[model samples]
Target chain A: MNHRRKVTVGGVIKYIVLVLVFIFLAGPLIWEISLAFKGPGDNVYAIPQYLIPKTPTVNNFVEAFHRVPMAHYFANTLVVVAINVLGNIIGCSMAGYAFGCLKFRGRGFAHGLFALAMLMPTEGLLVSTFLLVKSMGLTNTLFGVALPGMVGPLNVLLMTNAFAAVPKELIEAGKVDGANKWQRFVHICLPQVKGTITVVGILAFVASYNDFLWPLVALSDDSKYTLTLGLNRLQGTFYTDPRLVAAGACISLIPIIVFFAIFQRYLFEGLQAGGIKG
Target chain B: MARSVTQPQGRGDARNAPSARRHHRAIDDDGPSSWLFTIPAFFILLLFVFYPFLNTIRLSFTNSRMLIPGHWVGMENYVKLFQSDQFWTALLNSSLYVVCVVPFMLILPLILASLVAKGPKIIGFFRTTYYFPVVLSAVVIGLIWTNLLDSRGLINSIFQSLHWITTPIPFLTDRWLTLFSAMLVTIWEGLGYYMIIYLSALANIDPSLYEAAEIDGAGPIRQFFAITVPGVRSTMTLILFLSSASAFRVFSEVYVLTRGSGGVGGEDITMTMLIQREGTGLSARTGYASAISVVLLIIVGAITVIQQLIVRRGDD
Candidate 1:
């Protein structure tokens, strides 16, 4: 009885500590939201910095779109992300299916190479990647921005693991039914890993949307800038007005957050499997 | 998007003697259809990954500027790269940033994960809140923090009102403070990612072990040290290697914070940023930047090897 009482007190203390830590971790984002909604007339430099506005306005959001081609940038980012998602789905899935279910002479070797590809950081290859795009005449285009990243090593590994989790008997049954290798994969193996495919899609979506350095290097003109580069430009343009920068940042974070919430189950499963890839 | 068949829970190889033999036979009967399926990935890999990897090595030996290849410089660029003072400073700054931040990146999240593991009812809320910062773009995080710690930004605004410092401190502009601030942002953004990883590791530990410890009157801290620590030992090692690699490659955060010029007073430049400034654009020194990259890769690879040896020994 005494031990139980002690645990209750300990539990209460733990809750208080965790809640405080949570706020500290989440405070800046909340601050971004509060500051973003403030009207331009609001005195941002005033002491006792305000958390909420006396009258919140959409003027900052309006200003964010007006000062730049926010709409065109948004459309441009979507086109690139859409193309990347499509490319990774087709390419990574085909590769993952090959390695996962099919046993070939060099399956282990090819898979090992794929894993090595994932481990090797992109820093060493940036110069050639840039030169490759230029040689292909894709410099300063959205397709060029999406091309190098179209098939991720991580995505292939993810789909392979997901498909491998399917029962061996299922594939064997398809083989007995006179299905060819491709038919067995298409008819039998591919359907089971749909959740995993969604997981790969969500990962690709976030990676594509949040990508910075490559886009910065690939696209030179303002018209081709993604949302990330556009927001980056705002740091200089909105030099005096920090409120507008916060507003632009807030707007850009919305789609990814929505994707995260809607596909959370797939995301968590992918994250669990992700530790192995790491 | 297509649902062909649904298997039951806990699906794995169903052991039937007849089917097991047939499975092996079927695998042998399939020609090289597997390679056909892999061709898409291979085509992209040839153009993007493998070619680029080999090209980077070749580029280090030539004085190629922009896109055109030039005469072979052999060891000239490598010699200059080693002799450059700026390269050494960037390397030192990167080493300092890693040393200062990687420990916190692993341990702080671990402590938070243990906290998250304790509460059942509110676990979902805390988990989401902690992960919020990680999903955000580095540009957003860099901008937000740059503003937060700016001279007239949120931190200084509060400081002035409280009568702390009459003059706003230079958080982003100062030489030392600038590098320190970059680490601060990196650590802050990294916490959520590692916390979630640790939380998953914590979930795999047997709950009965803790219940048994409680039966013998072990406190939470003791249980954490004795049970939780040992259980997640592999995860800690994994994070240590990963965070070190990322810290060495730190680029976008510094890029946005410094407004895409070089680092503040050139003191906050990391290996990736140094490579970018030297290797890209019309005046690019392809050979010099490639030499720097080779050095960076060698360092990262050495750490990985050392880490593997240490992990293997620890396992034994």
Candidate 2:
């Protein structure tokens, strides 16, 4: 009976700690959500710090949209994300298949090139990359924002590992049936690595959606600003009011949350299979 | 193809036998076509990644402006960089960021991971909720924390209501306080990410070892110190390197908190911010910024090399 009490006590303590952590981690988000819905009549700086707005409304959201071209920014971000996802899917998968399955000369050299590219800090190369994009006449363009990150070395490697794990028997069987290389790759190898493909797609989407630094450097025009940049502008403009800023932030965050909720399982799996393992 | 059909071999011996070799040669004769597959990716990498890197090095020597391609200045930019007060302050702030932020990142996440590693069905829910911050853009995170740490914000308001102090803490106004506040944001944003990495590492540790420790009357704390610490040591090292490197290159948190001013009088600037400030805009000193970029590269590269040496030493 004493031991049972001790176990229960331990479990209770564990839960207490967990709850504290939850409050710390998710508190700001909840506060932001509350703040976004707060009407002008609500005292945002209340002494007790209410987690729910007394007079809940969508005025802040509407105000945020008016202050910035929120829908235009969203549409621009969507285009950039689509280009990135499609580019990474086609580009990385092909490169990955070549590296993983094909026995070709200078393969080691090609792989080394990718490894070197992976290690080059994007922060360090911001200037010259901007110059390159400018020289290509793609400055202030969505394509320029999407171009540099479209085929990341990490994704290539992730897809390579996935392709390498495709059973040899399957490939051999396809070869026996006189299927060409592309035929075998598409029919045999690609189907086996659907999970990795989804993971790659999700990763590409998140990276592109959340990207701010490169876009800041690439596009100088306000009309071409992505959601992150637009929200930053909103914050800069509306420094006095937290409500509109919160609403702007929420606008940028909701899609990511929805996307994450749908595909979070694959994300964790991808982290295990690709990130740490590599 | 005929040879593969006639002399079927096991997967293991296929690499060794001459017949299997012949079969592989016939089936895997995709030399030129394979090169075709890799072309598109390499083209992008070369154009965007490789060329720009080479160009940055070359541009550092020239007195290049944003529009006009200037003549070679021969280390003038580097000389100017070393003499600048802004460079020194930025370097100091970035170094201080790594020092203050990395320790919390290493420990907090490990503890968080252990707490959620084993539990009831609700643990999964906790894990998912915790990762919410990681998925949010850094801009959003910066906005969230900036409001919370504002002078009349939720935290200060709560403290004042409780009579903790008369005046609100200058979380984003004071120079050093602002730097530390940004570091706090970094840690808060990173906790879930590193926790996920730790969870994976924790999963790899042998369960039998824990059972053995339990049988020997070792308590949870004892087992953690003896088994768990050693088990996740490599992961700790990885987190150490990752956190430190990221801390050194921190931009968005400080950038957003200071509203792109890099604190009052630009006292809390970072290396990347310095690069951005100099290298961008119509009147950008591209040459000088390239020089800063080169310095940034060297420091980050040194960190990586030092980390490798430490890992090798630990292995030895």
Candidate 3:
């Protein structure tokens, strides 16, 4: 009976600690959400700090959209994200297929090139990349922002691993039936690794969506600003009003949250794969 | 199905075929088309990654600006960089960031992972919630924390009401406090990411070892040290390297937190910020920035080499 009591106490303590951690991790987000819904009459600086707004309103969202071109920026971000996702998926899968299944001369050397590119410190290369983009006359364009990261080397390696895991017997069967390499790749290998393809697609989407630094550097034109840049502008313009800034943050953040919630399983899988290898 | 018939045939072929013949077959099977498959990715890597890297090194030796390609200046840029006080401050700030942030990142995430690793169904919910911050961009995280850490923000108000302090803490305004505040945000944003990595590593540890320890009446803490730490030692080292490297290169958090000023007198600037500041815009000192970029590269490379040495030693 005493042992049972001790176990119960331990369980209770574990739960208490878990709850505190949850509050620590997720509490700020909740507060931000609360602040977004707050009406003008609500004292944002209330001493006791009420998380629940006394008066709720959508005015802040309206004001945020009004003050900044939020909708235009959102559309701009989507276009960039589309280019990034398509580019990474098509480019990475093709490269990955070659590295994983093909046995040609200099294959190891070619693969090492990708590994070298993967390990290159992007932060250190920002200036030169910008210069390269400018020399190509792509600066201030969304394409410039999307160009450098379109084919991530890590994604190529991930897709390579995925394609390699396709059953060898299946490939042999395709060969025996007189299907060429392309046909076997498309009809046999590609379908089998749909899970990994989805993982790749989701990773590319999140990365392009969340990318801030490159876009900040590449885009000098206000009309071409992605959502992150737009929000930064909003923060600068509306520093006095906490509510509008909170609402702007929510606007940019909600879509990602929804997307993450839906595809978190695959995201986690991709993250683990990338994390381990990287 | 035809697959069943071909499976044995494939096995027989594999058995009958010598390894040399298989290699020749594979080469013939791929042909030049395999090279075609790799072209697009390689093009991007060469054009964007490798060329720029080589160009940065060359540009570091020249006095290039944003538009005009200026003449070579020998080692003048490096000489000036060594003399610059701003350079030292930025370097010190970045190093301080790595020092302050890595330990907490190493310890906290492992504890979080272990807590969630084995528990009821609800623990899965906790794991997901913890990862919410990871998905949010650094901009959103910066905005969220800036609001919370503001003088009239939620935290200060709570502290004041509770009589914890007489003055609202200058989390965003004061120089050192601002850097530390940014570090806090870094830790908050990174907790979930590193936690996931640790969780994956923990899953690979042998369950039988834990059961054996439990039978021997070893408590959780003792078992964690004796079994869990050693099991995840390599992972811990990995996290240490990852967290420190990222901390050194931190940009967005400090940038957003300071609203692009890099704190008063730009005291809180990092290496990336310094590079961006010098290398961008019209009249930009691209040559000087390239020199700093080379410095950044050398330091990160040093970290990686040292980490490899440590990992090799640990293996021995």
- TM-score winner: 3
TM-score of 1: 0.92
Q: What's the lDDT for all of these models?
A: 0.79, 0.83, 0.84
lDDT for each residue of candidate 2 in A1-278, tens digit (9 for 90 to 100)? 23433456767887898899999999999889999999988998788688878899999999989988999999999999999999999999999888767877666567668766765678889999998899999999999999998898777767766676677889999999999889988998888777778877887887888888899999989999999899889889445799999999988888988888898987775554323212
Q: What is the lDDT of candidate 1?
A: 0.79
Clash pairs detected, candidate 1: none
The better-scoring model by DockQ among 1 and 3 is 3
The DockQ of each candidate is: 0.49, 0.48, 0.49
lDDT tens digits, residues B1-316, model 1?
Answer: 5533331111011111123333443353356766999988888777888898888888888888885688798898888888988899889878887898899988998988888765456777887778767767899999898879888888899888999989998988887788888888998888877887787789879999999999999998999899999998978987898889888888888888777765566877888889888888888987788888888878787777777677667756
Q: Point to the candidate with the largest DockQ.
A: 3
Q: What's the lDDT for residue A253 in model 3?
A: 85
Report the C-alpha lDDT of model 2 over B193-219, residue by residue, as the tens digit. Answer: 888878888988999999999999997
Per-residue CA lDDT of model 3 for A123-163, tens digit only, reads: 88999999999989999998888999899877777777667
**What DockQ number belongs to candidate 3?**
0.49
Local lDDT at A26 for model 1: 83
